[model samples]
Target: MASSDLTRKPTIRDVAAVAGLSHGTVSRVINGGHWVSPEARAAVEEAIRTTGYTTNHAARSLATGRSGSLAFLLTESQQLLFSDPTFALLLRGATAALAERAMTLVLLIADSPGEQANVERYVRAGHVDGVLLVSSHASDSLLASLVAAQVPTVCSGIPRAGDTPVPSVSIDEVGSARMMTRYLMDRGHRRIALITGPNDTPGGRFRLVGFREELGDRFDPGLVEQGPYERDSGNAAMTRLLERAPDIDAVFAASDVMAVGAIDALRR
Candidate 1:
């Protein structure tokens, strides 16, 4: 074991020493194991494993003009990040995926105008190579601003605001909702109440559309209630739905958290 590995974090030089190769050779292997012999690559890999060496992102950023980090930006209140389990799922997933590449994920929340400005500044300052935008609103100007600044951004859901079309990773929100509605209907559920998320979000808007389309002529406008994708909002929506239409036999909330809230209201 290298003394540096025990005393402090091991550096590339330490790895080179352990592998009995020059620092440049170690650097080449770290970059991608290309232009080096198989023997050299194997030795460096073993040394890296033995030393438990990690890339110094700060040094790498200065050298390559890349931050070696990505911002997991949430376009909602800071508290919402903790209160909503969906955000937690996204964070864990992104963290694990980035860990494999030895990259960092910075969490940022921008619900208000001030926070939005700060987030925009931080991202534009080259603190991160790109952004994974989450929980964005329909009219959110952040996407437009990021796009205008030529910053790389990929939304977690299909964005509805920008005319420029930001890159996104999303499931078939409409199809999923339609299927859920159909499933409920197949069970002989009538007088169904729809507890929709914020109308501006893709899930909120698209899911509502799917629910309405699935219901078709059976849809009751009075049974629909809109709220933020939060438990309390869901509870309130469900309570209102129950009060307005006591005959309601089923409901489809836009998200799992909201669905949980609706369940709470039913229990009450």
Candidate 2:
């Protein structure tokens, strides 16, 4: 075959010509964007199969100025986010949403400042149409980089204060923590101890605040502790809490995995 013919990727126009329909009709069927007559749809489908026509995502993005994709920037310590149940549910919801929109999802992990800088470059270069920022630490510079890039971003949780205005979606951590703490209080669990992870983040800070709020003036600040959101950290925190307040009736850890650690410590 000639180089020109060999190099040509089968496109919607070729499919349309083969099916004796307009390019718009082929586009509609291929993209599932609009309705088409049954007969014409069937003919177009047949042509697509025969010619092995595939939609070129890059070309479509160029013409439409939309990459038809979103990026999820996971900037936390991988062990924390990957092992946490909360992030697992978050992944499921985000995946389902993108699938429904017929868009692609690109996961970007930045565990260090250097990796984060690379992610910033990609964003500035327009590698994706939008981004979903998650688990940004107080000291993380990625937030500022993202803000400077001017990317359309939605956060899974708020970045630390002074981090730019990125819209986010998260449960009311303070409210949930307050409720949990109140449950403990209602059960007559007075000498309560708490294990929190990275008091810098919303989850840890809010849960600790809620515990204090529920305890009122009787709450001892020393009964609260902070740790790594890891099983080891949880185990250590629980041990320390036990040493510091042996008569504790209940303990609340910031995360479920940490809670498991607290349970392990309780058994010991």
- Best by the lDDT measure: 1
Against the hidden reference, what TM-scores do the models get?
0.89, 0.87
Q: Each model's RMSD to truth, in Å?
A: 2.6, 3.2
> What tens digits encode model 1's per-residue C-alpha lDDT throughout 1-268?
6344498888899899899999999999887647899999999999999888988877877877888789999998777788888899999999999999978899898998889999999999999999999978977888889999999989899887644788899989889988999999999998888888888888888888999899999988898999898889999999988887898888888877788899999999
Per-structure clash totals for the candidates: 0, 0
lDDT of each: 0.88, 0.83
- lDDT accuracy of residue 139 in candidate 2: 72
- lDDT for model 1: 0.88
Candidate 2 lDDT (Cα, whole model)? 0.83
lDDT of candidate 2 over 1-268, digit per residue (tens) = 2347546887787898889999898888877766798999899999988788877988787777778888888877778666788777877888899999888888888878888988888877877999998877787877777777788988887567887787888878888888988888899988888888787778888788888888898799889989777888888889998887889888877788889888898899
Give the runs in model 1 whose Cα sits over 4 Å from its true position: 1-18, 47-55
Residue-level error in angstroms, candidate 2, position 208: 1.4
